[model samples]
Target chain A: MFDYLQYVRQENFPHIWCAGCGDGIVLKALIRTMDKLGLSQDETVMVSGIGCSSRTPGYVDINTLHTTHGRAIAFATGVKIANPDLNVIVVTGDGDATAIGGNHFIHAARRNIDLTVLLYNNYIYGMTGGQCSPTTPRGANASTAQHGNLEPAFNISGLAIAAGASFVARGDAYHVKKLETLIGKALQKKGFSLVEVVSPCPTAFGRRNKMASPVKMMEQLRDTVVSVEKWEKMTGEERKGRFRTGILRDIEKPEFTAEYAKLIEKMRPEE
Target chain B: MSNDRPGKVRMMQGNQACAEGAIAAGCRFFAGYPITPSSEIAENLSVMLPRLGGKFIQMEDEMAAMGAIIGAALTGQKSLTATSGPGFSLKQETKGYASMAEVPCVIVNVMRGGPSTGMPTLPAQMDVQQARWGAHGDRGVIALTAKSAQETYEQTIRAFNLAERYMTPVILLIDEITGHTTEKVIIPDASDIEIVHRKKPDKDPENYLPYRFTDDCIPTLAPFGTGYRYNVTGLCHNETGFPTNDSNEIQCLIERLTRKIEIYEDDIIRNNELMLEDAEIGVFAYGSVARTAQAAVRICREEGIKAGLLEPTVLWPFPTKAVLAMAQKVRAIVVPELNLGQMAREVSLASQCSVPVHKLGRVDGSPIPPQQLVEKIREVV
Candidate 1:
């Protein structure tokens, strides 16, 4: 077993995630990835917005900033630009990153700033007691959507790709090792990178749907996710309910901070 | 960047002077969205910051601009953002976070007539009350005002200094007239000015407590990438910088937010009272309107109306002591501002209604002329 305990704040545990919540699985994967990369605790900063997933930073023993609702990406952008040497990771949720924070989400990707975004898509506002979120599927029951959600769910990976992120990937809690590999690849990417983890929020999201049991939700995620190659080969009708769970987009781009540093050097007066 | 050019005189706009002042005050990061009457500050910094290896980012929106600066400030970078009335309203929530988290950053609000973008290109002092109570909180805020391009430059530096000294967001409020006004500014030598930096922790990383109480009630901050790794949150946190639901801990955190600045009120509050030693009438004014009020007082004095002027550069914590002192020296107080009567109400309340406070306001997108202030003063007499 990996010594993930060495990277966490022992006093803050036992963790806040409920029994069978997939957030813990994702947290463990993040820790394991950090350990694998040998990231220095002192030089890494974890920023989060308001959500159950945003609470991830509080348990980590690193420079963490728990900011206002839906502003984590904006804050993380500043941290990255201010000190490009530091590794910046933004931990946010579906509602936080897509609903109230939609503008910042697309803009940060557009800037292609070097920020690793671990956006936990639980499909509902878990912290706010199961309100309908941007990722809440149509016909899904939520506290706010008691009559079934009328809005269409957002394609989290597609949105990042369209917004010009250098790397975009989708992973789920059921596939823990694969999720760890995706996160490690994102951390290594040069520009804006996003790993949308489809973690289960059983307490808030699952109890309303037919998958009230955490095991059932985990099984549903396992059954629905297909590899990118498998997804591409599927017919349009066959792909209706299934989603791809691998690197969706990857390319090279000039990162914002490096370009800014170059601009400074060029503009600096000669000694 | 060596400040070898001492007393170098230049004709500059208030917004440009504000940008120069930020550079002089060691502000290395600026994040702002363009809004009229304040965009010059952003434009000037974009051209200047790169030359000095400082960072300037035009954020996507007003709230992002505010959030970015707070984020930069946390990493031990002196940060600033400029906006107008509508943008200022958008920044309130994040501004409150800066207050609660005690992140040191400067926000410059160049006043424009507004209830919501009322007049983008025109001057109005309507946001005076918003500067003090815009955010939902009980924390103490430091807000300052300037009446001229030269004063705006000096006060911009003061805003940064105060933000650093107390580790709180300092708002510098100027109006469209002052922001666009052109005046001569003498750039001071770097050695001639005092620069205050945020106090960094000297203890070992293991024992570092981000919000531990000190003798002055101000906490020393460690840069994010440094050895000291701590958490900062908007929640009512304990000294260890983690959320606490304990009643005593919550109360202490809430009280300390205000107490830290209130205890140093003497060092923070600044005002200028002229010819009020024996005058029977006094005019209380600030920002661009103060210039007209000063002229009005001089005219009234020449006309033998016994009028004086009280101009406050620091607007919040309400300058109670100075208002009370001025009330004793005058029978009536005249306040002429671009808004209807924001600061006049503060003067009236601070004076305990000892003197009848008159308000001379104009929000028709034009500044109150000196003659109009003189008329208000004469009417009060």
Candidate 2:
């Protein structure tokens, strides 16, 4: 235990975030990663859009901005360009990043701005009660989907890898150490990095659907998610109904903030 | 300035003057979408602002355009964005959020021809009503009009002051013609201007409440990461700024949002009076269109017609006192806008005893010329 308590609100220890809420686990992982990297608390900025998981920044005691829903990346873009010195991270939920903010997320990744996007995927809209989010399972019992959800879920890691994200990884909150390693790796990677954490939302997605409790949710995640290398060796039937997880891609183009700072240095040069 | 007490003289277009005004008012961040007439403001800002170590970002959409400015402003950057008519329409929702959250920002809407994507490259005044009612609610907007390139400069400076002082989004209404029609302007050294900064919390981060109001009902704003642990939501928020759908909170917020503007009528609104000292008929106009009215006034004067020009620098507090004062002296008001009759209606509403408020506008991508304005002025006079 690397004293992850520094990044948590212990008074909010039994947080409104219920048991089996992977948000806490992912948040803990993020804190551990920050600690491992020894990132300066003074120079770190964490921004988030609206959602249950977007609330992570407020607990960390860093420079945090709880911005408008679906516009965390855009706000982070401004923050990065403004300072260019601070380590800017956008903490967004599945719906916040993938749905309403889809355009901004793609464009930011495409620009390869030195932004780290931590996307928490709990598979359902957790904040305003359980609603059908963009990442909800194809057939799930959500508020909007009485019978079942009809739309196919978005493969977020695949989308990030495709949209020119320099580093893309997927991990479940159940594997805290491995997840924290991925987060630290993503943070240290020299370009736009995304770590999609498939967390469990017991209150909304679990309780309503009679899914696993906290411990059993971790067990289900451990049982269901297979690493990409192992899944590549698995047969088609073995991979059915399973969302593969691992470091999907890691290749650099150009880092956004440094390049911009370079251009500014070269072009303007203090007049 | 009817008082003819010349303060500062600068040769600038209505649009370029707007950028200078924003700069003079200490705006450090500008994010905008390129549209006709308003592009110069963005262009000048991009060229000049960075020279002063200010930041400029060209956003992807008008929605993001406004959002970037609002965000930067919340970061304690005096920020602004300029766009034309269609882009102005796109910014309405965000502008509404700025009003509700009282995020101080100056938005320049260079009026262009359209109801749809009608005129991307032309000028219009139809956006007058849109500037007021464009956002969803009954929230009051502080708008200013520019006649000369010089007035555009001065009013744009005023727009920022009013915005920061009042903690609201102030709109600088310029027409496409004024935006494009350039004039020579001397960029004064930075020392010659009075700039007002948006007031922020003096209390330590631990004791700050983001939207706590002072006696003026105008509260100080705290930038993000400034240690103010408060939320700014589009929903009706109490002083602490958490979303409260409660009716009492809702009414108090809306009333303060509206009255903070409406109550400061004398201080917040601005316009001009030209030869109205002895005239019986007035030519009311704004932006570049007001120039034609100014020329028309001179023409009417040469022909011995009693005509004057009321160029409103502030649009939404609607310059009612000017209209009422002129209404007592003049039998009719000839309002020439670039669009169909938006500001003319406000003139009618503000008029006393059914004074004839006639509108002469051109929405077909052409300016209402001075001769045409002169004819309207003579007929009304």
Candidate 3:
């Protein structure tokens, strides 16, 4: 087994995420990816917003900033631009990245700043006790949407691709190995990279929607999502309730920090 | 990059002077969104910051701008952001966070008329109260008001110094009149100015507590990515920088944050009293309105009304002692502001309504002329 314990705060063990929650699985994958990359804990900074998934930074043994609701990417942008040498990662949730923080999300991607964003999409506001999020599916039950959700869910990966993310990928907690690979690729990308994880939240989202057990929720994710290549071959009827998971978009562009550096050099006063 | 080689005089707008002052104060990061009366600061910084090897970013919104500066400040950089009334309101959310997290940064709010975008191109001092209480919480704010382009330059430097010294967000309140007006500013030699940097922890990384209170009630900060590996959160946290539900611990944290400024009240509070020794009537004012009051006081003194001016450069930590003393000595207090009796109420409360308090206000987005203040002084006298 990998020594993931070396990368986590031992005192912060027994995290606050509820039993059967997939946040731990995704967090472990992140740690393992960092471990594989041999990134020093001192040189890495994890920024998070206010949410259940945002709590991952507290357990990580790295320089962390637990910021306000929905502003992690904005804060991470500053950290990256201020000191581009540090590897900055932003951990946020569905509501944190798509609802209140949606503007920052798209703008950060538009700037193409070098940041690795891992958005844990549990489809409900778990921290606030099952409120309907921007990613909450249609006809889904939530505390705020007791009569069932009336709005269409946001395609997080699609949004990232449209917003000009240099590398956009999707993964699920059930496929831990694949999720680790996706995160590893994102960390290696230079510009804005987004990895949307379809993590399970048995306590808040699963229980309310009748998928009360972790196995049932993982089964739902496993049965519904197909690979991008497989998804392309599916007919409209077959793709009705299904989603696609894999690297959806990958392209190259001038990163914001490097462009800013060139601008500084060009504008600097001659000695 | 323009000319920092000592004793250089240049004609610059108030906003340009503010940007120059920030550069002189060693501000390395600036993130702001454009708003009228304050956009010049952003434009000047965009050109100036890169030239000086500093970072400048025009964030998507005021909230993001405020958040970015806080993030930059955490990395041990002197950061700043400028906006007008509406944008300032958006920034209050993260401004409160900066206060709670003990992040040192500067915020410049150039005054404009508004409950919400009331007058974008006009001047108003309505944000006087907002500067002190805009953000939700029991937190201390250091605010300075500048009356002229020259004063704006000097006060911007002082704002950064105070922010670093106290580890809090300092507000520089400028108005449309002063922010846009151009005047000659003497760029002082860099050696003549005093720059204060935040204290760094001397302890090893394993033993460092980001919020451990020292003798002065101020905690040393360790920059992110420096092997400190600590957390920074806006929650009511313990000395270790982790959230705590213990009421006593919360009380200690809040008290230390507030008392750090309260105990240093004398050093933090700054005011100027002109001809106050023999005056029977005192006019209290700040920002652009203070200029008119100074002129009005001159006219009143020539007309033998014994009127003087009390202008506070530092607005928060409120200058209570001076206001009370001025009320006792003067027969009446006249407060001339661009808003309808905002700081006037503060003067009245501070004086306990002992003296006849007259509030001369204008909300038409125009500055109160010196003659109008003189007329108000005559009516009070």
Candidate 4:
């Protein structure tokens, strides 16, 4: 078993998450992955916007910044550009990343800046007590959407891929083992890499959808997720309640900081 | 005093001077969006920052630009961003974060006419109040204004200096006219300029407190990626840099944030008083309006009217001491602004109604002409 205690701020324990929240599982997977990758705590920065997942930065013993709602990527962009040697990771959630922060989300991907974005898609705004989010499934019940959510869910990984992110993948809270593997790959990727984890919100999302039990939510995830390769073989009708997981898109490109370093060298005046 | 120092002299626009000034202040990171009257600062830095081994990034928007600079500042880089009215409004939330987090950065607002995109190409001092109270919280704000390209160059450096010294966001407010106007600026020699960097923590990493209080109230900030691993948040945090709900701790955090700047108010305020030695009437103005007010004061002196000018380069922390002293001597004060009586209200409060404070304002997207100020000064005298 990985000793996650080494990475966590022990004094901040009795953590803020409600009982059986998938965000904690995701957090465990992240630390385990970080440990496996041998990332230096002094050289790594974790930035987050406001949300339940944003609390992750406060718990981690690292150079962390808890920024305003939806501006974590923008802040992370500066950290990476200011010193490309530092490993910068952004921890954000569905509403924080896609609603108020959608512009920054797309632009950071477009810049292809060196940032690892761990987007926890809990399908609802859990911190604000289950408000309808950009990724809230259509017809799902939420505090704001008492009757049902009117908007279609966003394809988060597809959005990253379309916005020119060099690496994009999907993982789930139920699939914790594979999630670590996916995160490890993302941490090693050269450009803007995104791992959109379909983490479930048991209290806010599950209670309204009649899956109030955290076990039921995990079971639902287990039944629905297919590997990316297997997903391609399924017909459109067969993908009704299911989603794909694994490295959905990966490519090579000129990363923003590296290109900037080259520009600095080329523009330097002769001594 | 070092204006006559042997160095490069060039005629440049106020916005260009600001970019060069930022470089002189050891600003190695610039994150900005293209906003009217302020875009030239970004354009010039785009070419200059790279050559000088600095970093320049044209962010997605004004809010991101503000956020990026704050992030760069945390990583031990002197960072800056420039914007106008609407963009400044967008940046308020992030600017407030910079305030609460105690990040040292500079924001340059080249003022343009607005309540919202009112006029992009013209100059106005409408953001005077916004720069101080634009963010939601109660914070000690440092905002500086300039009258010409030469002053803009000098004040830009001072803006960075104050930011580092106090570990707070400093606003450099120049009107569109000042930003667009071209003038000769003498770039002081490298050895002639004094630069200030944020104090780095020398304490043991095992007991590092990012927001520890001191007698001076200013806290040393360790840059990220240097052995010190700490958390920074917009939420009210304890000395340990972690959020705390304890009321006493919250009270201390808020008070310290304000006190750090207030205790040093005398050192932060900068104003120029001209020919006020034996004058009975005073003209109070800033930015481009002050340039015209100086001319109007000269006109008043020539016409046998005892008139003087009080030009405050630092707008916030209000310059109350100087205004109070001037109020005691002058019979009446005339405040001519590009906006409708923003600073005039401050002048009234600062003067404590000892004498009547008169306002001469124009929001027609143009500067207050010297003749208008002359007429106003004549009426007041």
Candidate 5:
């Protein structure tokens, strides 16, 4: 048995995350997934940007890099290339990946770098006191927008798939088993992979939206998420209040690392 | 500073000589984009590194080139990147990253003219200020200037050692003239010289902090992939190398980074005085400009104007003390630069004497003629 208790630093636990906080749930799902996949402590590396979710690296037993806000992918790309054998994983929040780090995330996906990116979509900037993030749902109330957000949230799974990620999936941190499986799939993918874990932000996002508790947020997630095939079958009116769940896209392509190595070998026959 | 290769004397441009210097310094990884007078460094490195079981990459741009060098260096290899003007401008962010993260790498800039694309093949020293302040944020940079093809080799080795010793990036500043002008350089065997390696952490992997600093302020460098679990970041960090927004932590980090270099200023500076003992007039210059100043001093002396040249081989640290001490004795100071007047400003600032300072120059592709420099010296005399 790969013990979760053994892998985590006990003193840091009962983490600062609020009750029903999707970040806590996502962390649990990730831990379970890594254990299930049989990735040992030493072979793995976790990297993160600045956010409530980015604190994921601090508690993990594996090698970790806690970098500048929004540049986790860039640093992870460097780490992966420097040692191609290490299993690289990125933990970021919605604001961390899609806003400031959007350029790096898109380029890394398009280039098909072999790495897993777990974007916790809590729909608001939690650690920085709930400014509007890139994925704040339409009309969501945030500190920056007391009048409610006017911007449309990104379909993160769709964005990653369109940007040429080899595997893309969506999961709600409320769905424990599903979240774990999605993470496992991303870890096993040969190229860029993103698992958008739609997490609950009860402290800032939920309380303001009248979904004040984890129970209420989980109920909303359960009601709003529709499978992609069912989403297609649903009427336009039905689609307006819901978000799509399950695998949005999965592709097969040569990863960034292997392809670069191939080019090097071709030019240098002696190698 | 090893003479790993024996009995090799070649007539090579200063830029190519620097490439050979990098090779002799144990640089096995080079990633750079070709630009201006610095193109020869990348071209030579591309030809040489592959033969030594190392990798050489021609990156798409200078930003990536800098990132590549840092990534390569993290693997315990000596790495370098070369660029000029526009390309050098693109590398500032990563250079700051190298500074904050304390990566040991060599950056060679063969400066050309202008704000942007001023003189592609011509010489300029406009980047003297940029060498000190180019990278964003508060940090210390190790800048070394080379005056000849011979010093180009020696300075290249010194750059790596200082970088290793201090755990920071060292900029080798060479103008286009020194980069392109041919000179006689002798290469000795690797066994003949001492090479410095950064002290690594002795603690267990779990206990190692990436940015751990000693009382001397130098951090132990643990080359990546040694199973050491330490993080490196570009953000202002505490001694552990993880990003921190605390004001005190930020202050401590910047203070320590700069103090590490400023404290070692004496050991980091290099310069020379040519016939200063009996001279009444002085010429202050650096890099390739110093070479022409030496010639000008000789020409002025023959014309009955007693003068000497002060050559600054280690530019930033500036050798200001030497200039200030010599300033009180000389009646006049002459500065000749490839740019309009970069180093002349420093000479004027450091001189305590009320000496009349004059500049002999060119922003064009040509060096300041010896006759013109001699005339400038005579006028000041």
Candidate 6:
């Protein structure tokens, strides 16, 4: 059995996440994955941007960097490139990943750097009250958009794949086992990997969207998301408002830091 | 090509010398984006870093570039980034983050005309004030200005040393004239240069606090992966490096951040005084304009007038002591800059209006001629 408590900073508890919040579940999944891989705490680094999900790094017993809003990926990229031997992970929220940090997000993927990014998507900005985010659904109601958001939500997994990430997957908080496995696989990959977990924010997002309870929100995710195999069998009509989960793209490609190292060797003068 | 040769002289551009200086200072990681008058620094580093076994990344934007260098710095590597006016504006948020978090990094802002990309190819000292106050919140700043390739090289090495000693961001404010102008620079041997590294924590990892204040007001840094799993944040935090809402904790943190440089102002300030022994008129200048001021001072001496030059090598923490001393000795002061009266306002304030200060400025993408400065000095006298 993996002792998850060993990887947690008990002194830093209790965390600031609200009761019935899915961030705790996502946090547990990440800890379990790290435990399964036997990654030493000294060799791992957790980087986060500003959000409720970004607070996940503080509770973990690793070298954590709590950075400014929406720049976690950029910072993580630097950490990994500077020291390629260390295992680097970025914990970010939908607002932090897709809004102000969107440029860094796409570029990190495009470079295919060896960083494992876990994007906690709750469809609304939970930190700043409840504002409409780049990942907010087209018709969802938020504090900033009382009459329903007019912007279409971005498919985070799809964006990562399109941006040239070598490994991309999607998971939800309701399916803890599957999410843990997906995160483990992402860590095992040698290039840019992203696992977007559809989490729930009962305090900010759930109340405004009529899913006021955690059970109701999890049930909605369980019902609306289909497996990749099942998604292929579904017709266009059946997939209208639904999304797919599981590994969407996994392919081998030259990683950024590895390529840079090779370049350094080639450029070195003969001694 | 042989940097190992002691005192080897070669023709190099100011921007190239700045890049060479960074390598000489042991900067192992560079993250930057291309912008005019500053692009050569990035280009030179892109080739130089890899050959030196350092990492160089062309980031997506200025914000990412700044963020990347800070990340690398946390891992115990000397890191830097270069940019121009527009990019400098884009980098302010990260600059403030580095200041608050006390990350040691260097930012080279090759100034050009701007409020928003005013003139890309032209030179301007418009960013002197912005370099000091560009980042939000109350924080002390260290900025250096260079007038020639040799100074850019030496000042860049000093900038890195100061950044490491203070554990803060140091800005190298270079103008288009020096950044693009070519001159013969003597590259010194690596053994001859003095390099300063950040203080590392001597305590065990279990008892280490990343932001614990010591006698120097700077916390010892433990590089990531050294088994010290401490937290670094932009928030106001305690010695434990964790965010706290206690009023006293916030006050302690902010006070130390500002006081670390303020108390050490004597060691941080550097200025060059030229022929002030019997000068009745003083000319205050920096960056490329200082060259023009020096020439004007020479002309004034030859014409039987007593004029002198005071060029500030370090712009922020503003060299107030030297300016005040000059004010006491001279009847009047003249400040000529590429921007309209930016440093003039600083000189006037530093002098406390005890002496008459004259402002001469030009912003049409041209260097202030020596003749114009001589006339300004004459009028001030």
Candidate 2 clash pair list: B11-B184, B11-B185, B125-B339, B143-B315, B144-B313, B145-B313, B280-B330
Cα error of candidate 3 at position A175, Å: 0.3
Q: Of models 2 and 4, which has the larger lDDT?
A: 4
CAPRI class assigned to model 5 = acceptable
Give the Å shift of residue B279 in candidate 5: 3.0
User: Mind sharing the TM-score for model 3?
Assistant: 0.98
lDDT of 5 at B156: 91
Per-residue lDDT tens digits of candidate 6, residues A107-218? 9999999999999999889989989999998888999999999999898999999999999999999989999999999999999999999999988989998899988988
Number of the top DockQ candidate: 4
Of the two candidates 1 and 4, the one with more favorable lDDT, higher being better, is 4
Candidate 3: residue B156 Cα off by (Å): 0.6
Worst 10 residues of 4 chain B by lDDT: B1-10
- Per-residue C-alpha lDDT of model 2 across residues A92-161, encoded as one tens digit per residue: 9899999988877887778787888999999888889899899988788888887889999998988987
Q: Count the backbone clashes (under 3 Å) in each candidate.
A: 0, 7, 0, 0, 4, 0
lDDT of 2 by residue, B28-124 (tens): 8898888876888889988886667778878777777787787677777888999988899988887887888788888988877788788887877
Over B1-381, each residue of candidate 3 has an lDDT whose tens digit, in order, gives 123446779899899999999999999999999899899999999989998889999999999999999999988899999999999999998999999999999999999998898999999999989999999989888899998888898899999999999999999999999999998888888998889999988999989999996888887778988889888899899998888889999999998888888888899888988899888999999998989988999999889999988999999989989999999999999999999999989999899888988999999999999999999899887
Q: Write the per-residue lDDT of candidate 5 for residues A176-262, one digit (tens) a residue.
A: 787788899999988999999999998888888898787899999989988788988989999988888777878788997787566
Off by over 4 Å in 3: B1-6
What is the TM-score (0 to 1) of candidate 2?
0.88
User: Residue B71 deviation, candidate 4, in Å?
Assistant: 0.8
| Superposition error at A67 for model 1 (Å) | 0.4
Candidate 4: tens digits of C-alpha lDDT, residues B287-376: 998889889999899999999988999998899999999999999999899989999999999999999999898999877778888888
Per model, how much of the real contact set is kept?
A: 0.88, 0.13, 0.79, 0.91, 0.18, 0.78
Q: Mark the regions of model 4 whose C-alpha exceeds 4 Å error after superposition.
A: B1-6
lDDT of 1: 0.92
Worst 10 residues of 5 chain B by lDDT: B1-10
Clashes of 5: 4
Per-candidate Cα RMSD to the true structure, in Å, reads 2.0, 3.5, 2.1, 1.0, 4.1, 2.0
Candidate 1, A151-203: lDDT as tens digits:
99999889999999999999999999999999999999999999999999888
